[model samples]
Target: MYAVFKRELFSLLNSLMAYITIGIFLLAAGLLLWFFPDTSILDYGYAELTGFFSLAPFLFMFLIPAICMRSFAEERREGTYILLATRPLTSWQIIGAKYFACLVLVVFSLVPTLIYGYTISKLAMPAGNVDTGAIIGSYIGLLLLGAAFTAIGIFASSITKNQVIAFAVAVFLCFIMYNGFDAMAKMALLTGLQDLFMFLSVNEHYQSISRGVLDTRDAVYFLTLVFFFLLLTHFTIGGRKW
Candidate 1:
């Protein structure tokens, strides 16, 4: 597993696509948080990063899919997946390595954003008037969210040989998981099931954690979601073996 993980991580780092994807995410985030009039922190007259936290998931919806689309798709497309599978590693080990590799790229994209928090802290009226707890919670929530998205993306990649299709499917699934439940709950037909729908929404749990409370329920929901998607990927590749 470690060998696979190392190889996968190095593959991502060596790929120009990975650099471009991370670059775009950071660029867009910078524009939204510091330049755009509507969402810019400069106009907010405060040290809060509410705009960043709110907009990040939307950016991630596309970024993560792009990163993971080629994980298995390219392997299958080039007929290299067979070679990979013939190795000593178990299915879970392979999937785990790829998932963590993609996740590390996600973290690489996010780590630079810590500068934003630092800048905000220094800009505050007093030296550091920002809500440290909230920021910490939001970062934690974002990491968990990224992990779940990585699992979904890996699952999407495993089922298809077409990278484009994998990307589209992953993005669609991420969007639906993130917001569709909330939208469904608002419909008249689902009115009685609003609570349940909201409970299932990734955004709901993310927002809950972003509030600095660190509820175990939200953590469990994300962990379970990650596991569920990874399990799906295992089943998918396992089925292909037969």
Candidate 2:
């Protein structure tokens, strides 16, 4: 498992697509949060990094799947997945290794954003006036959210040999998990089911953690979602492709 993890992680780091994906994610996020004329921090007239937290979830909805689309899909595309299945690893371990590899890259993509936090802290109306707790909590929410999406992406990749289909499926599932429930909750026809829909949404749990409360339920929600999808990936890999 560790060897598979290392191999997959290094493969991602050594690929051009990985850098392109990271660069695009950071560039779009940075511009939207602090540089774009309309949405920039300058326009917000505030010293908080809240705009970033507001924007990153939407950005991650696409960025993460782009990185993960090729994981199992590309392996199967190039006929390497068969060899991978022959290795001395359980389906769960193999899927876990791939999941962790993508997760490491996700963390790599997020670590640089800490600079935004530092800058916001010092650039506030009063030096260091930022709510450090909320910022930390938001960061935790973002990482957990990313991990959940990675699990979803790997599962999508496992179900198909087409990277494009994997990307589309991952994005659609991520979107539905992240916001579709909230949308459903707002529907007039589903008004009575609002609470249930919201509870099923990853965004609901993410918002709870971002509020700086660190609820155990929110943490469990994220872990449970990740586990469910990874388990699905293991089964998908062991079964026939869709």
Candidate 3:
């Protein structure tokens, strides 16, 4: 698993497209947080990263799929997945290695954004008036969200040999996971089931965690989402063999 992880990570690092994608994510984030008049934190007259936190998941909807689209799609396209499957590693191990590798790239994309928090802190009244707890909670939530998205992306990749198709499917799934339930919950006809829909929505749990409360339910929801998607990926690859 470690060997596969290392190789996958290095492969991503060696790809120019990976760098471009990460760079685009960071650049877009910076522009939204600092430059865009409507979304800019500076214009909001607050030290909080509410705007950033709100905008990030939307950006991630595209960025993560792009990162993971090549995971299995590229392998299968080049006929290298068969070679990979013949290795000693179990399906879970292979999936895990690829998932973690993609996740590490997500982490790398996020780590640079810490400077946003620090800058906000320094810009705050008295040199540090920002809500530290909220910022921490939001970061944690973002990480979990990214993890779940990575799992979904990996699962999408495992099902298709075309990277573009994997990307589109992953994006569609992520959007639905993040917003579809909440939308359905809002329908006048679904009032009776609103609670259930909200409970299943990724945005619901993400918002709960972003409030700096760190509820176990929200954490479990995210972990379960990640696990469920990964399990799907495992079944996907296994089915290809049979």
Task: Tell me the tens digit of each residue's lDDT in model 3 across 1-242.
Answer: 99999999999999999999999999999999999999998899988899999999999999999999999999988998888888898999999999999999999999999999999999999899989999999999999999999999999999999999999999999999999999999983766699889999999999999999999989999999999999999889998862
Provide the clashing-pair count of each candidate structure: 0, 0, 0
lDDT of each: 0.95, 0.90, 0.95
List the candidate 1 regions with Cα displacement exceeding 4 Å: 188-192
Per residue, candidate 1 scores C-alpha lDDT tens digits across 142-191 of: 99999999999999999999999999999999999999998988883755
**lDDT of candidate 1 at residue 137, scale 0 to 100:** 97
Which pairs of residues collide in candidate 1? none
lDDT of 1: 0.95
Runs with alpha carbons beyond 4 Å of true place in candidate 2: 188-192
Scored by lDDT, model 2 comes in at: 0.90
lDDT of 2 at 190: 58
The ten-residue window of minimal lDDT in model 2 covers 233-242
